[model samples]
Target: MPQEFSRTERVADYLQQELAKLLLHSVRDPRAEFVNITAVDVSRDLRYAKVYYTKLGVESAEAATDVTRVLDKAAGFLRTEVAKGSSLRTVPKLTFKFDESVGRGRHMEDLLGRARASDALRGNEAEADDS
Candidate 1:
């Protein structure tokens, strides 16, 4: 027999994989184009699953409520499909959250690049002035 993963871990894994797949092709909503699930967290009792996601190419990156509505609409379908392979007693409810870490990281990198350029320009000016 295969080793059984903990309930929470299994749920998390299922949500991550299944939701990712569902978002790729099954979902018909235009709003989903900018959304991508980054991570999933399932409750110990399998009552809830928190999905961390990010918005790509969208201004303001929207909010959790946006994903929540999509998740709410998709939950029944996700649960039904997830239950097909999972032996767990219950499939947790899906809750989507906007994960901004990706955007934040890109912003930080841009800031660093600008700082480096400024420093280089300053160094060049100082050397010119000393000549």
Candidate 2:
């Protein structure tokens, strides 16, 4: 029988959970205080992992860049911390990326709200025309 989850997927899940905890309670940088680990993608060879994160209440480009910089600067420390909790032979290189999907989702919601309002107005106009 085929395995339920591939090794890479399992590793990604482990990294995601552990990283979330470490970022929340271990990392002391103020800039990383509100960082949320959105997802973790591990390569097939497990040589590198892309860590996606987004800062709570921070959507500006500069703020995103700042968080990314801080995380990247602390990558080595984070890797070591992860190593302490894992049985993997080698910890994958960490790369921090600011996840923009949250911001994009917000923007999409705003657009959808406007569209709904526009449709409502048109509906009212049509009702008035029928009267």
Candidate 3:
């Protein structure tokens, strides 16, 4: 019978939890202070993992770049910490990536708000004309 969760999936989930704790308490860089781990994707061989992260109150490209730089520089240390905390024989290399989904969602919300406001205005104007 096949396992309910593959080794890679298990590793990815473990890494995500450990990394979140590490980022929250271990990392001290100001750029990474607000970093939130959005998702973790581990390779089937468990040799590499891509960590998606986002920063609070960092919307500009320059700010995002700075956060990414800090996280990437600290990847080695993070990986070492993960190795010490987990029972895995090999800890996957960490790659830091800025996740833009949050920002995209905010933008979508703004667009939706504008659309709704416009529709309401049109409805109001139509009612005024009908009266």
**How well does each candidate superpose onto the true structure, as a TM-score?**
0.80, 0.95, 0.93
| lDDT at position 126, candidate 1 | 100
RMSD of each: 3.3, 1.1, 1.4
- Candidate 2 has a TM-score of 0.95
lDDT tens digits by residue: candidate 3, 24-93: 9999987688788889999888898999888899755556888888888999999999888878899999
- Which 10-residue span in candidate 2 carries the lowest summed lDDT? 58-67
Off by over 4 Å in 2: 60-62
Where's the lowest-lDDT run of ten residues in candidate 1? 58-67
Whole-model lDDT, model 1: 0.77
Candidate 2 lDDT over 60-117, as tens digits, reads 6666897888999999999999999899998999998988889989999999999999
Native-vs-model 3 lDDT? 0.88
Candidate 3: regions farther than 4 A off: 60-62
